[model samples]
Target: LDPFVDWLQKRKIPRGLGIVIIYILLFAFVSLAVILIIPPISKEVTQISENFPLYYEKIVNGFNAFKSNLESPENTEQVQQGLNSLGENLSATVSNVAGAIFSIFGGLFSVLLVLVLTFYFTINEEATRGFIYTFAPSNIHPYINSLHTRIQKKLGSWLRGQLILSLVIFALTFIGLTILGVPYALVLAFIAGILEIIPTIGPLIAAIPAAFFAFLQSPVMGVSVIILYIIIQELENHLIVPKIMSKSVGLNPLIVIISVLIGAKIGGVFGALFAVPVVTAISVFLRDIIEKKVEAETKLVQ
Candidate 1:
């Protein structure tokens, strides 16, 4: 079956038939993914949209109640000061929230556009590569081609691994939240899934609201939520990440952190989403160059 598919990919089949097959496979895979994931996603998004203000109210009320329970006059003063600051920045915060929503929708559109473009390129991979190579100098064309292929494989693997990781985290989060009777479990879990793209800090950020909500229910529950999040993070790091992302990139933790920070600084969420893959591509190309140079010098000495 693999050999036959390779032969078909090499264009032994009629062009129209091959195109049909490609579309059929693409459709089937996409359909399967959507069928499996879209219902929970739609439910989560709908619930969040409808109840966001309610959740906000809960958080505000929780904070206010906690503030009232403070014994020290100094503590009350600090709380009042914090409230005043929050009020003063309310308009700016609202504006930032609107901008973030706009950015998220824009990013979603861009993702769809990219997926469409990728499908076209996948169907015409050789032609696309050839077109790119036409811009390169003849002497360096082979090197460029090799580098492109390596980058493509690295990025493709990374993307698939990332999707799997995110889905797993989302499922784990939703299940845990549901068990813990956390309100907005679906919404929080969705956020966790989306933030999983941001690498090291993503899970921690996802855990914040989960813990806060859990804390709102009870201090003990909150503590439990924190512990749950820590365990999930451990599982993701020690088990899921090793299995899924082991082949994707070779960058060390320090490089990954710096790249994520720089990416977020430059392009916000979109930049951060792409940081690891971009770094991986650059690292792979540079390593290849160094290896070639070393080989040349060794040959010269011999």
Candidate 2:
């Protein structure tokens, strides 16, 4: 904040005007990005909405055909019972899916609210930091400031790295699907990109529908889609994640999985999406505290 103010002061531009100009530019960049991404996303969404029922119908028919094959006299009762259970839950499943779809729209307002708040914070960065400093004791200010800096660095890096990873996944998925002659490549790849936000299980979720769609075309194509996604996931896990995310996140796979599960249980998709960063924050703070305590203890002993 001081550096920014000094830079503006050097140029003889008023601090307030500089801040406002920076905010405006930031907002403009964000708006442009949103505008560029939204049209293709909306097109894919619309296509999915219109065609999903037909896909579901085909899936149901396939399942029924499979069930018929299990109707040997010896297996009749077991198959019938399983089918009955599935039939009973079908409505509930549809209702849950509908609710999830509706929840996606519910997050739009939250995104807008974040953008607005960010604009305010950017314009008043020094004031906000000073106001926060007022509430803490002087003795702890240095530690608090240090912690804040570390958190910001970690989180900023994490977000940027995640964004790059998602973009890479989106490009690979789209290109692979296109080359394979898969229909709805744009939509499937977009889904893959967006779901990359959730680690561990996200890629698998994105792959299911893609494979299903490919299978609808032909079995060989289905196999190709599966192989393509497997290659993508391998590259993501072994290559991209190691290069981009490992340093930024610095969390074990087990911890991430646990945090994601807990977050999903508590706040659904939004919780899961943010769980890693929240855990990262906590870990960073605790790590800093422990190191400071050890340093203080060493000094006392000396």
Best candidate according to lDDT = 2
Show the lowest summed lDDT stretch of 10 residues, model 1: 1-10
Model 1: residues >4 Å from true position, as ranges? Answer: 1-72, 83-102, 132-142, 250-280, 299-302
- Assess candidate 1 and give its lDDT: 0.76
Please give the lDDT score for candidate 2: 0.78
Query: TM-scores, in order shown?
Result: 0.73, 0.74
Cα-based lDDT for every prediction:
0.76, 0.78
The residue-by-residue lDDT of candidate 2 on 1-302, one tens digit each, is 33454588689987778767766886798789779876776677666666766766776677667777784765766765775576456545644654776788787765566556655765676687688889988888788777767776676677778788899999999999999999889878988998897777889999998997899778899999999999999998889988987668456667878997998799876676668768888989989889889999999999
Tens digit of lDDT per residue, candidate 1, span 1-302? 22233568687675446656766886799789778776776675556456555655665686788888888989878877886576456535534654665676677755566556655766676788789778878899888877877887766676778889999999999999899898778768888998887768888899987886677678888998888889999999899899989887645667878997898799866677678778988889889989999999999999
